[model samples]
Target: MSFFSIFISTANAAGSPLKQFEIYSIAPMHFGNVNVSFTNSSFWMLLVVLVSTLVLSLGVRRSSLVPNRLQSISELLYEFIANMVRDNASQDGKPYFPFIFTLFIFILFSNVLGLIPYSFTVTSHIIVTFALAMVVFIGVTIIGLVKHRIKFFTLFVPKGIPLALAPLLIIIELISYLVRPITLSVRLFANMMAGHTLLKVFGGFVVALGFLGIGPLVVTVALYGLELIVACLQAYVFAVLTCLYLNDALHLHH
Candidate 1:
């Protein structure tokens, strides 16, 4: 058999469907000399933003002594993030509450939106996640410098270290600081991509096996539920880490 045929046969044996994901270019645009291609992922991202805005806005539109369902949910979400900020970030970091809260909400919405059928998973792409990571990285760096001026470099120096080991410690610190963006971006992108891919493969098996595929179908359903939890958890993790990073910038803790 040809390679394609063999691949299909293997998928069949493993109870995977033969469906494959395709990346499509939706539009081409130019910024100065740079060219950018908008894709299906971009569309889904916009949709997530719109839906999130509507949901949150509608939920908080009215205030009652005892909140109705929507108001209660909105208040709960607000309190959750407010507590997260208070717990992780210092007093000096309170001004950044809006940015951090929006970051969490956007990530949560995008992840949940991607779970819908026929939807594109924007967080699955390294470029998209990396861009978000870079924003946090760059913003924190700028904040550190503005707050500490030349003394911001002190962030790289660990307190109580011996003079002889100071250089080594600074080197390690610099490397760790430089790697934050890569780690942050890769963690989100890899988890989302892997989970979605596994879901797709298992879903394909259910379709291909006809009546015999009930086992995999049930497992896929279970995994889908689990993925929803993971999606929310990952968003919370990303936001909490961002808060931690902001705290480091504000306090210059080693």
Candidate 2:
């Protein structure tokens, strides 16, 4: 079965860990071989995009020498992402700031939005996260090949390696490089899925345990707080890693 379709069975069919990632056709449509239907996942994705755009647009509508609260928040995010790219990818990375910034914000917003009662988290799906990772992976690979040509191969062969060990190290490096998308996608998906599953399970306890559930409720509150922090952190880590990959591509550094 297809990776995206794997979530189909469990997502909408039942109330299980996988149910949160389910995508169903809101208005099912078919164009020959392709199914172009608007599903809940699509709804959430559009909502994420809309909300992100609105916040960013309104946040800096009135740019000023002395920033107000919204403008300050906007500037903070701008500078924060700028510094991340600068630190990891340097001046050359400045050109891709918008892409990186959009990605960071989108994921951050999605994660935070998911914490809302009865809301869906887009990043919890492997297909979604994998697509995002693949974009970065492919983009970096293209940049490296375009900039360095065949020399991009050197990325797999570190300097000062003994001649005999070069083959082994090169193989290891190649495998690691190729697995980036798998690891990146799985990390975000697993984290969101695990966090939400815990919340769901504990929520059931709260409803079932009644007054005694106060302790679990308190823990739930703390978990929510931690999840918020994690939402922001995972976004930062994803963007930072993107910059790092871009740095590798641009400079061909080992």
Top-scoring candidate (lDDT)? 2
The digit string of per-residue lDDT tens for model 2 on 1-254 reads 99445434433333565566677789897889899788888888899999988887788887789988887887899999999999999999999999999989989988989989789999988899999999999999998999999999999999999999999999999999999988888888888888888776666556556787686688788888888888888888889999999999999887
RMSD (CA, Å), each prediction: 3.3, 6.2
Model 1: how far residue 249 lies from native, Å: 0.6
**Which window of 10 residues has the lowest lDDT sum in candidate 1?**
14-23
Task: Output the TM-score of candidate 2.
Answer: 0.92
Candidate 2 lDDT at 38 equals 84
- Residue 241 lDDT in candidate 2: 90
> lDDT (CA) for every model shown?
0.83, 0.86
Alpha-carbon runs more than 4 Å astray in model 1: 1-21, 27-38
- The prediction achieving the highest TM-score against the true structure is 2
Write down the TM-score of every candidate: 0.89, 0.92
List, residue by residue over 175-249, the lDDT tens digit for candidate 1: 999999999999998888888888887776777667866977898999999999989998999889898888888
